[model samples]
Target: MPRSAREPGRATVQVTNHRLARLPDVQSQEVAPRTTPGSGPVVDVEQAEAALVEHYPRLVRLAYLVLPPGLGRTRRVLTAHALVQRALPRRRASASVIPAQAAGGTDGGGEDPGYSLLRLQVLRTALEAGRPPKRTAWPRRSQLPPLFPQVWGLKLFPRSGGAEELALDQQLSALSGPARAAYVLRGLERLPEDHVRKVLSAAGVTRPTAALREASRVPRQDALLESPEFDPCSLQARPTDLMRRRQHTKAALAAAGAAVVCGVLLAVPSGGWGPDGAAAPGYAQNPAARAALDPAKVTKVPPTAWRTSARTDFSVWPARGGLTGDTALLRRALAVWSRPGGSVQVSATPGTPSGAPAGPPQLLYAGRVDAARVVIFYDGLRLARYAEPARGTDGAALDFARVDAATGAEAEAVVLGRADGNVRYLTAPWVTKAAERDLLEPSAEAVDLGLQDGVTAPLAGPAEATGSCSSWNVLQLTEGSGIRLLTDLGELTPAHLTVGRPGAPGEASEPEALRTWSPFACSLAAVRSQGVRSVNAWEFARQTLPDGSGSAAWVCTRADTWRGDGPRVLAQFQTPGGRYGAVAAKAEGVTACGTKDPHVLAGVLWKSAEGRWYLLAAGSSDTGSIRATGGVTGSADGNLLAVRAAQGAQAGLKGTLEDGRTISGLR
Candidate 1:
């Protein structure tokens, strides 16, 4: 492959300072045969630098292949440069062997003996920097993938969102550190077993082959990058081919990048539906009808398309066994999947519970359909025990991307409510300044639950009866407040929430009293049925559905299929004075526990008093969503309640297309 050269950065130490005559190995190489005029003897510093510059890009490629590959190219190249730097000083000191290819400035593998030493030092440094106990820069990308456009919400590709590489990186990241390193050095670098042993030994690993074996076991499902063999020389692919693919994908990525980036709340105004379920005043193609045309297409989902899922994924690291983890996971799901038209309170702090075995599982739900739709991100799952204050603004703040994923390292506090031992939902506050800026920024901090937050009054389907005529608490996340508000129905008094009710209290009405009067629905039994052993905490919420029907979305843990035991995730909306019916019901041999029901209404897809029409929505699970028992449609009609968040985008903004339909977006 024709590769572009990365410009070299100058080192402060001048090349003339290197004592070439004192070192035995470098003396044999073809240096200028003369040292600097004043300096006694040293390797030709300028000449040695050229070699590093020539190989820098390739070395970076190698580094990316080996190191935990989540960081973007910039960080990845720097990491590779770290390895080269380790060998640079030695080469200048005359202690390094000349690269077999250095004479010709080409990769003539196995001819250079010094390569082993250089790789050894680099691998050792990588292992040390990559390991724990110190807040080194090595693990940053793994904990949090560079939050740049390189990897955003799953826009992997219609040629736009090429999630294949991301999926591959995630799979590689899944391996243990030792295993990952072993595979890199032995597999990618083509180092001998003994050399690999030395690297692994320096890394403090007891079993070298076992680590490679473990890493080699990385699952290959949707990921396209194939596993490296023990010897890379035997591999047949060219780098140019891969680069060409990326180059091509880049063009498509730019053009098709129309789907608003993650956390950027956008909307598709509701229009009257045709008998074919198309929008009344539609475009060339009713974008909503694409759901029916191709069940897999999720880009620019139409206002009428509703897809909700109760993904029952593996829960190895959940709290109270699984409640705390599941609760936080559900919160994230609500935040990412149901946004653009709904409310979600995300208070996630990964850690081990008081009596739990370890910490929560490391979850990375990067989907094939929507690389941007990261429903769950449990990267900092490596938190230790809770040594910090349970309730306070005093302890070290939890960063989702930088925390360790291992257990027993630095313990994380599981802030469960005393009322029912259930996980508490906290809110983060922020301003919706712009789509790329504040809208995509993470929630600032976590808040604690309040007392009245648990009170419940299920809402009906009528427009007037949705959130009002009921008493409930909202987990409020705001830039100013760290806790949610547990308030009565009339108590949800934000500017937009209280628009109809003029006498309600709001941010202007009172100071930050989100915790006051917030009821505590700490009881897991509130949603648990007979046969399930445990259920995560839940809340009764009021929301509007895609059909513009008012309803509630039940956010809870996975349910039991055999006994239909766990908390119901969706409930049906009824007219005023009637209990909301159950829209999605668990049935034995019928309801597939692996998939989520997309039609389950949880969040609002569109809301427009400007036109007096609103469409509700729910999160669609990427995992096998079409296997619904009732033909994959309307399974979760009214189960979820989509509440408008108290924080972010103080008001909704809009524009109009030539068609009768309207377009909505975050301001």
Candidate 2:
């Protein structure tokens, strides 16, 4: 078997930075105090506060420099200020044994023990802020986003600099939290490698040497650290989406005026307003809710708008259907969405909010599907469906799913109806063809489904499959550029499927891509109603069997959701001649096997055809080494490992990257 031919790339640095930003803040633990050989000078609260006040700007800049740059400039700035403001100790504490930074630097605060202590406190909390929050502990004050010192309606960021500064910022962003601290201390504080190591260790870095080594990769540009680009104290303010803010203000004023008028008319003095069919009683005082239910206020885009629109998403999708002009049906749909009655069946995809719309939603469809009157609505963040018996409002159903930021093929189609073991889709105006194909039979030809007014013909939906999992149906939509596969996930929207490596995934229409999906097609059932946006399959490694039986491929499939939080990851192994891939391991809501963090580790216990058992594990190509612990203990170079073991054996796996960092396997 061949080792992964893929070369190591710089993406790991960016990925590491992304993973560090989302890490939960260390809650329950304080920064280990950096003690000197002898008892250090004790600094009182007054002295600390005095140091903080006199050198507030420089201290904030230091904190900002030390903090992870992935936090975004605005958050980093606010966090820096908050950390510096809170650096004053609650009680007397021993000052840092390390001496003050070099002279001739603008950032240098006097050699006051108080200043030293404040610097340590700021450095400690900033580093802690980058760490993941512990599950068993409560969050420390510094770990949470700063509530005070927030500037409303404005985004503050340091002044922009030239290409040199930009390049430096990008390089710094690639470094880990401790590495960033080391670089900042060395460049900004004029601390030598030895003193920087001491400060980093005192600040709780487990491996200061590795951090310094990583920091050394960035070229020395200490003078650039003094530029305004890195200075949080000198900030430029910009209004946040001024046009959107104005529109919201206008909407608020209009709603208020309408509420007053409606209140006067509905103040019956005896009984409240008349019944709102299948909807919860409306509160006369809630103007936003009232306005959202108005049929006339519903946004309707022109039919030809998509042809000329720059943005390609639901926002550009024009309203269509026979009853688009029917106000009565539209009113019923809006009312039901706001507050479905007890008799109405309501369902929502995971992480999707079923609450009333904040404003008038855009109309996507309003007409009939089979024996039911159906309507679809989009409100920027979510897609909502309302359906009832064609005869009357009886047996109404409302369903919601998150669809934020959907674009291209992802927003290409949506489910319109499901009845009699078949599903129908309402595709975007851009779709030129629609078809259905069995995923289990990758080589099978696609059956074309007629499209009338962008509505796809009824086809067997995989979501409704039960009993034997013999056949899995997936919808195929084709536009000018290429084709895409979307499968019913028991939600109002279908999840798109792609094949390739992370970040650079392509359409799963090619023969190779189709074959890659055939084995694990049934695994799609695991992510039903998960608000899945898209799923990507990537083959990370190929390992030769230790007993010379054959080689096997290790592939990872990840289902990314619309809410962007919960992702389902599955590691599967397929022997050379096997028809289906076996699930080696799986996990949910993990950063591993994701676009941001493309690396994954998984292990499986396999019994050879000759009756010998083994423990096999694999990681991404960048993995330098793998070591199995627990039930079966073995170590191997590179990402692939095969160790003889008993049947059904259990083991824990950890991988060391080419860099010194170690990562645990996906459970």
lDDT of 1 by residue, 197-220 (tens): 655775468888788678668653
lDDT of 2 by residue, 536-560 (tens): 9898888887667677778899999
* Model 1 TM-score, all chains together: 0.22
**Candidate 2 ranges beyond 4 A from true positions:** 1-275, 283-288, 463-468
* lDDT of model 2, residue 442: 89
Maximum-TM-score candidate: 2
The true-versus-predicted C-alpha distance at residue 277 of model 2, in Å, is 2.8
Query: Model 1 segments beyond 4 Å from truth?
Result: 1-51, 69-74, 81-87, 90-108, 135-167, 202-207, 219-667
